[model samples]
Target chain A: MPLDPSFVGRTYPPTAPYQVGREKIREFASAIGATDPAHHDPAAAQALGHPDVVAPPTFPVIVTMAASSQIIEDPALGVDYSRLVHGDQRFSYTRPVVAGDELVCTNTIEDVSTRGGHGFLTTRTDVSTVGGEPVVAVWARYVIRGEA
Target chain B: MELPAKTFQVTRADLIRYAGASGDFNPIHWSDRVATKVGLPGVIAHGMFTMALVGRAVTEWAGSPDAVVEYGVRFTRPVVVPDDDQGTEIEVTARVREVTEDGLTRLEVTATCLGDKVLSQARATIRSAR
Candidate 1:
């Protein structure tokens, strides 16, 4: 079954605010072996003009990935989780994500298409503060592989 | 213009830590049992992990921790990570494709594993640090 093209341009509601934690940023930075002092040292981050440890550029995936389930798990959308593979990912940030920021995401389905028996779904998540300050806009394209 | 290349280690431990940190508990990244069951060669590193490595290189080249304004990539191949201390190594290299007068530097990036390209069309635009 192909993805519902009508779902394109459909926007989901804002997710609950996710409070960015300093330790989480440190852990993610450590996982990627990012030895930048600003990622682990609050004092160093302060020197850089952030309130606390600033997360690495790709850190927002921690928030967008979870919030994306709102669409992938929607029964009407019929996204087969087993066949899902990340086709592409893009992030445009207004500013770096720092610790102590409460973030919210509003997901929108931008495009849906099927080619060569593979289903492609592109979704954009507008990540912003609970107060609606734009932070980063994340775009993800997922490919649903066809049966061999 | 050419930028410096960087190599990153991708061990199973790194995959596990990335899974926990990124909340992508996909068995293909951690469980060899499930990974092979699904026809993968073995447990593999997450695509996002590779992207993160590229981000690290971008920031290093830009001379700022938060210099990236736009980043994107396509996962073309998987980085197979073994269950060992020295699991695998990904070599990331990039060239300055353009430097707009507005102070944004666009980079064309390539990430390879065992000499095979793992990411395609990987690119980043950073606010160049003067």
Candidate 2:
């Protein structure tokens, strides 16, 4: 069975607030092999005029992905978790995500389709601060192999 | 959640290696002239490449790429790598935020470039092994 069309436009609840910290930033930087000081050192980040360490350009994916599970795990969506592969991803930012800000995310299903024995799902997630400060919007397409 | 802060560095060679690894040859990432033509100060790194670094961070921390059920990021700023003697550096940090009822783990994370906000806000979900 394919995904439910009714699921399109469905919006999930907002994720809990997450506080940005220095250590988490450094660990992420090192894991990605990003040897940049600004990700870990507040003094370096301060020199660059930020409240604390600033995240790299693609950091929102972390939060948004967590929020997206609402849809992926929905039995109504009929998505096969084991067969899914990332199709494409893009982000539009209202402002940079600096450390020390409390953040949350809301995920919404944008579109659903099928082609050549595969299910295609598109999702849009909004990551923001608790006070509703827009940080970034993530648009992603995922592919699920058909059960042929 | 909190952890000890750490640091890292990005050398010129790292950019070249990333270019090769990701199969993205955007001249803006390798050629100063082309980068400047596009309005960048100098060679700029690919946004996805930077994010992949973050992915590696989260995946390694989770102990498996397959564990990363979902992840995303926005390119808030350009990581400008100058033609100076010392190369630019991109840093990152991550921590476990929560564990869901079904054993899903959410990570709060951030990555930066030499103090500039390169990757503004980031997060990921790691599905624990069943």
Candidate 3:
């Protein structure tokens, strides 16, 4: 079944604030082999004018992906999780994420379409500090394969 | 100008670690059976993982972890990872597309595994370190 184009422009509520942990940033940086001191050492991050250890560029996916579950699991939308594949990703940052920050994500379904028997869903997530300062805007496009 | 290429190795162990840290427990990234069942080649690395590697290259080139202002990529191909001690390798290279007077640098990035381009329209805009 093709995605409901009517679902486009639907916006979900903001998720609960997620406390960005120092060790989580370190672990993510380590997993990607990003040895930059700013990603690991608070002192190094402070030298760079950051309040705490900084997160790697793609680290916000950890938050946004979870936040997007609201849209993916919407029974009315009827998305097939097993057939989904990542199609595209983009991030625009107002500032880098730092450990000790409490972040919240507001998810919006930007577009939904069907082409060549496949369903495409594009979502935009606005990540912000608990105080509502925008941190980054994340966009992801997921492709749902058709049963051929 | 062309930037030096950076190569990163991806082993199955690394994938497992990433899955834990990123909280994406998708079995297709670990279970070859699930990957094949989904019509994938077999146990593909998470697309976000590959993007993170490329982000590393961008930040390294910019000389700061917070240098990037915008980054985007289209996932054109899957980086299939075989279960082994030596999984696979991704090579990332970038070219300076533009340098603004205010010191923003735009880069066109390329990432490949087994000489096949895995990402297309990959680009990053960062604060110029120079």
Per-residue alpha-carbon lDDT of candidate 1 for residues B5-75, written as tens digits (9 for 90 to 100): 99998888888889999999999999999999989999999999999999999998998898899999999
- lDDT for each residue of candidate 3 in A1-148, tens digit (9 for 90 to 100): 7789999999988999999999999999999999999999999999999999999999999999999999999999999998888999999999999999899999999999999999999999999999999999999999999999
Quote each prediction's TM-score. 0.98, 0.55, 0.98
TM-score attained by model 2: 0.55
Cα error of candidate 3 at position B72, Å: 0.7
Q: Is the docking of candidate 3 incorrect, acceptable, medium or high quality?
A: high
What lDDT, from 0 to 1, does candidate 1 have? 0.94
**lDDT per residue (tens digit) for residues B6-125 in model 3:** 999999999999999999989999999988997888999999999999999999999999999999999999999999889999999999999999999999999999999999999999
Query: For model 3, which pairs clash?
Result: none
Better of 1 and 3 by lDDT: 3
Model 2 lDDT at residue B73? 61
Query: Residue A71, candidate 2: how far off, in angstroms?
Result: 0.9
- Tens digits of lDDT, candidate 1, A67-141: 999999999999999999998999999999999999999999999999999999999999999888999999999
RMSD of each: 0.9, 16.1, 1.0
